[model samples]
Target: MTTSATTNAAGVATERSSRRRGGLARPTGIPWILPALVVSVGVLYYCIGYTGYLSTLKWDGASPLQLQVGLENYARMFRDPIFWRALGNTALFYVVTFAVQVALGIVLACLLHSRLYLKTLYKVLIFVPVVLAPATTAPVFRQIYAPTGTLNTVLEGIGLGGLAQPWFSNGTFALFIIISVQIWQSTGVVFILYFAAIGQISPEVIEAARIDGAGDIRIITSIIWPSVRGTTIAIAILSAIGSLKTFDIPFLITSGGPTYATEFLGTRIYRISVQYSDVGLGAAFSIVLLLLAIGTAVLIQVGSRTREEKAGV
Candidate 1:
């Protein structure tokens, strides 16, 4: 009886192992990837298609009577002054943030890659802001820029009290504050990416440049810049997308206030959907935002590729 039981157990284990092998050795591999394929095609695209459908109707999110409005929402969006202002803000924000972050990130990354003192400490300091949540930091920024906050106090102590005023009350100043906050929070990510790209460079190539009497700036502009084109293109796409969907800091700090100066597509969408309870208008805005983000990324990528091909890069 004991011998017969051992033989049955061994046979069962062998059968299970062979079944596992057969599953992995399937030629098509369709079953292995079906879940992800379903998620992408089924869930993701279905939501997107549903949003497109919602954009064509006028509904208050919970109402059963969804009036078919066709393209009226899009037309209203185009004619809306606040929408234009938000679009302009996004454009300006993208340009300024992209330029400043690129310059600062590249310079800092290069310095850190060299024989700089306290490299590890500097790296930690630089990256800490990236990990900090915007929700937590937004209140801090609001207080600092408040009319009687630390900034004004410091200004008074330094005899620059004459320049101290309400920073967030003015439209232009509020927008500037938003831009500054974004740059502070996001530059660390840009720095890390540049640092990694720069690290991949061959030490021998940099040594050759040094031996050829190339200064730091010369080597950076010539060798390092061209080599990191891929990283820069990636950063550009990310910046474009982030700019299109800017909401957290602006909504928390300025609330897109001071006469809609800091309004963005994301903030507008939220206000329309929740505050106004116009889900259809919000859906239209969201659809446009999605298209713009995708289009901007494609334009940047294609433009970069075209330049590279033309220059034989």
Candidate 2:
């Protein structure tokens, strides 16, 4: 009997020890995420830190990186009038595009949400641009905006020939035209996002508001806006970042000309680095663009958080 009891106690202790060892061998959340963490750090260092290092050196593409300028590129960039003009253009583009897109998106979403004829067809038509490649669309727009292109033809056909000018050739109109094309291509994305956001809202709540004798404007202002505020904020930030980094359309169309009228940071960087063989200056410009984008995003997030806090959200 004594021997059997001792054997049973030994067996229990061994079982407990094995369980503890198994627990130690099992992976935790940190171990599972370590690979992702390593990759992210490597990418961030290579992209951001390496770019920063390049910005401090005066090196062309084919030559050795020998000249250490130490912020001279940034100093020259700030002193250049072209840089300021590009910055202004970028700011204007973001403000106008963001405001128009948001307003148009909300209006379209609301309209499509209502009982309308051929709603599905309307949605498909509006969303077609979102799926189309920018490379495909930019060339088409370039042709349309040419001196004797479809836009001029339409103006002449409608007896508005006086309003038609050399769209891409004129400095005054080139930036506006680029902004319009950007808006045309990207508004659909914003509209779809807002439409989906609105769809997620509770239908019963809206019906309750209607039953309580709330007007359409009141219902929208008090209910719809509050519910979709987060979506609106997100789209606003994205639009700002995209506008700041705008390149494809403006580059493919105007090439940042009629006399640098449509010059933005993205195009400027390419021109400086590839066209002029000033990689260091280009790196500095890139860093500035990165900072601008980060700043804009941070500002929007802070503003949204503050608004939410004040509203008791």
Stretch of 10 with least lDDT, candidate 2: 57-66
Model 1 spans > 4 angstroms off: 1-25
Write model 1 residue lDDT over 1-313, tens digit each, in one string.
8999999999999999999999788778788899999999999999999999999999999988999999999998999999999999999999999999999999999999999888999999999999999999999999999999999999999999999999988999999899999999999999999999999999999999999999999999999999899999999999999999999989999999899999999999999999999998999999999999999999999999899899987
- The backbone clash count of each candidate, in order, is 0, 0
Stretches > 4 Å off in candidate 2:
1-21
Provide TM-scores for the models. 0.91, 0.90
lDDT of each: 0.95, 0.91
Residue 60 local lDDT, model 2: 92
Tens-digit lDDT track for model 2 on 71-166?
Answer: 999998999899999999999999999999988898899889988999999999988988888889888988898889999999999999998878
Shift in Å, residue 8, candidate 1? 42
Q: After superposition, how far is residue 163 of candidate 1 from its true place, in Å?
A: 0.5
The Cα error of candidate 2 at residue 125, in Å, is: 1.3
